[model samples]
Target: MIGAALLVFGLTLVLLLSIHAAEARHPQADFAAPLSYREAQAVVVAAQAREAHLRTVVSQPLGSVNPELLPRMQTIYFPQTGHHLSNRSGFLDFWRANGQLQSFGYPLTEEIVEHGRIVQYFERARFELHAEYIGTPQQVQLGLLGREILEKQGVPPRLDEAQREGRYFPETGHTLWGRFRSFWERRDGMQLYGMPLSEVVEEDGRSVQYFERAKFIYFPEELPAVFRSLQHSYGYPLNALYEVQLSDLGRLLAEQRGINLAPVPQLEGTHTWHPALWERRVEISIGEQWLSAYEGDLLVFRAPVATGRDGFNTPVGDYAVYYKTPMQTMSGCMAGECWNVPHVPWAQYIVGGVALHGTYWHNNHGTGIRPSHGCINLRLEDAQWLYEWTSLGTPVKVRY
Candidate 1:
């Protein structure tokens, strides 16, 4: 009986030791077991909860007019941050590849049509989709935000040593060749023109360069007679001289930014107009530097005027006041002569970009110095009077 009892105790002890050995091998609950359906579902739901943090962008229609032209929906993914964005179409990829993710950030809104062109706004940049340039190299382009910003600040980018000596600015990607290199250097490079704001843009069949204070155009094919002769005699490149004319861009630029650099003087009250004011007419003599405003041949106002100088001669023709603004910003440049006058008050655009406006820069209106680029310059009060008196479509005759 004692032997049998001892045998039973030894077997029990061995069983206890085996159980301890198995527990030591595992040390914890067995995780290798296949999860049940409920457990698997919980795991999946947790993963989805994490992914739900990614932003989902939605694209809205620019308008009902061109639904067929709308871009198909697309989602963008940033693997590094595990952030997702949608509705950017190819712009997201383009932005990523072009290093605009940090500079421009994400899209503020879906693509929309602006000024008859498809455009998308980002934080620091505006992406213009030139559908008209489909299949061309310019299908996508950046707006002149940098230029507009610089013009607003009245401070442009600084130039490097090469740019100071009149070379293409490295900041402009070197596409804007030093077309006005010598001219810009000779005519006060930094203090006068600021830096080149834009690359050479083809507008109205001519290449144009926008400077902070001026605009220069390229007329390579048709050089003016004087410049043509200079090209023949002195081997001067007319391509860089006569063909390149100064353009008036201040008012237009200001309009684009929706901020007036020059505010018009507000009249105390609306002035009563004379019945004859409806028949107001203006006459300018380029050679005499004179302007005369008349009502039915009865002189209403006469003022000494400054016309365009030499190469920037005022156009001699018949025109009418198509548009009149209270204030305008005038800017132009060509060769060695350039002018960027901001906040010009009392402007009446006669034809093209030429206007009769107040001139605060110089007091020599009646003087023989025809310092104006093309527009006629008047004294402050005279221009204000004319601006108030003149009517749109008023006939203007500019001669000699």
Candidate 2:
């Protein structure tokens, strides 16, 4: 096996050297240009900087590229293209020059073996995704979701209010049209996929979290296009598309290339899970509310207790399971009435000092809609079992 690998390596070296020498003779062929002493010195500096930039991209899971692939690439590959590759700087230069499936990260044939660089089926040329979605990663989701929504249900024409002059409504009226007058006028007709823009947020005003961190994937959104249209009346596809989140897909492909994931995502540990490994996560609807908890992703224990009757509503947010104490004492009342309560062994999650433990004074466990100072109260034994089973950094997903 070693001998065979050596032969392949030697052959590849010869091929690449021949390409370079031949290109130098021709003065221009692949990517680099001729170098005088000044240009050579500049090339050396530029090469180092370009390498640093590719290292950055390798470090991140952008699009379908993997984080693990970054380390392998850094260790194995050497940078040659210094300047004259598109005038972008740093990571942007790497992206413009070498990171595409069609351009630099060229797809490899079976005969070609990349010792460290990411060699995949992807041709390194056709990566136009970067050009289309550049400002923020969120745009990828919007573009994909919008196209999916449109494909499933065709675009409705803009709305026309009969009351407005010079604006006409079609006889079929597929699109709910609005007047193009003032910003405030008839703007109500335009909606995202079918949901009114006003209802984009919940009553409490927390922007809806589309990506669920525990699963490292986007929570499935309903098929707005299919559900609303006659084209999808039978609903052939369950969801408009089996959409993968921008980060998740990239992380998945990186793993396939024998890449070494960083600190938290190490291999051969007591617990090692990548976002790509999960098949499906179950969504548990405990009460009238929907909150997600993955089976292997987290451990859950429920308890009930008394809460504020009036002003002190418990704010909801995501937190990590920090510590679980066997027995602790609760002294000072939240209402400023001091009382030392002993024998409270709470399972604590340190997202704003909240806990899930047994309540000695109250029997109702997270259901009667009673308010407390944000700590969950449960029976003593359940608390013990949960504390035993849960690992540090396990997430607690609580929503109503």
Candidate 3:
């Protein structure tokens, strides 16, 4: 009887040891085990609950939008997409500042948290919130969805050498050719899309190419029916069937993550929304030595300028930009003072012998140190931006 009881106890001990050894091999055995139908449902329900909580956290207004920009933050509803962009998040301003419809396309999802950062999705782009750059122009940045998508599929092998027929970027051993080349050159491709990562490849039965920041798909067929109707209704050219169209990577990635993209109603009690108030105009404050450029009511650019000193005051009146040149040799003699400067960059002649040009001679702007002869002087970059932003007959107003 004693031997029998000992044998039974030893067997039980060995069985328990075997079970522990199996568990040690697979540490996550409990978690890896096939869950029951009800357990799986519960897991999904918990995930959905977490997502709902995050959505609430992101949607609640943080009171972060600048008060001055509140007017421009008016909620905009896109009837075609059935989506509304709320101004509370300051996305509308960023969207408008950047190329709105042309660059980002329509909004795909409202502001949401992804990867511990607040973000929103547009049709072709993703907008990420950079709280570190808040109150600055770099507050909103574009996510690298193109690179991310390519990474998921494994990065393509780069070419050994750049091709000779088209624009070749030796940086990535990729060539931009054909319709893609035309589109890249026409649009601010380098700045907007970054470098091409791969040559054209077949993706989902379409000719597609990947860039560092964007994906382009060639659509040879006629414009979609909705776009055709928009072309007729809005008078904008929505017919780019022959051209390479940007893929809706933002929408695609959001869908892959099972994000909710249902359209929400327009927020109540917001200011009236306006579209494309592009009336390029410049205003100079002589007393403050400041210049402001406006597109309709939207203040696009502003900088300190060195106006004329006592006798050579920048004339306080309304003038139009009648002439522009990339570089000029400005030579003039006024009141016994003579200056013969060469290679003066970005000269936009607004008045007689008085132009808005960059000054490398002195940094005494925004103060009455050493002012200009009779013109307005600006920093090299500011002058360049203003030069590009203005055109012949752009209105310029000088005030005290």
Q: TM-scores for all candidates?
A: 0.32, 0.27, 0.45
TM-score of 2: 0.27
Sort all candidates by lDDT, best to worst. 3, 1, 2
Model 3: per-residue Cα lDDT over 38-88, one tens digit each: 343344335334444554454443344566534355566665565667655
Over 4 Å off, model 1: 1-278, 336-338
Give the Cα lDDT of each candidate: 0.53, 0.32, 0.66
**Looking at model 1, how many pairs of residues clash?**
1
Q: After superposition, how far is residue 161 of candidate 3 from its true place, in Å?
A: 8.2
| Model 1 / residue 272 / CA error / Å | 12
**TM-score, candidate number 3:** 0.45
Q: Model 3: how large is the Cα RMSD against the reference?
A: 29.5
Which is the winner by TM-score between candidate 2 and candidate 3?
3
lDDT of 2 by residue, 125-213 (tens): 11122334456432111112223323444443333333333223253222211111111121121220222111112213322211111
lDDT of 1 at 313: 69
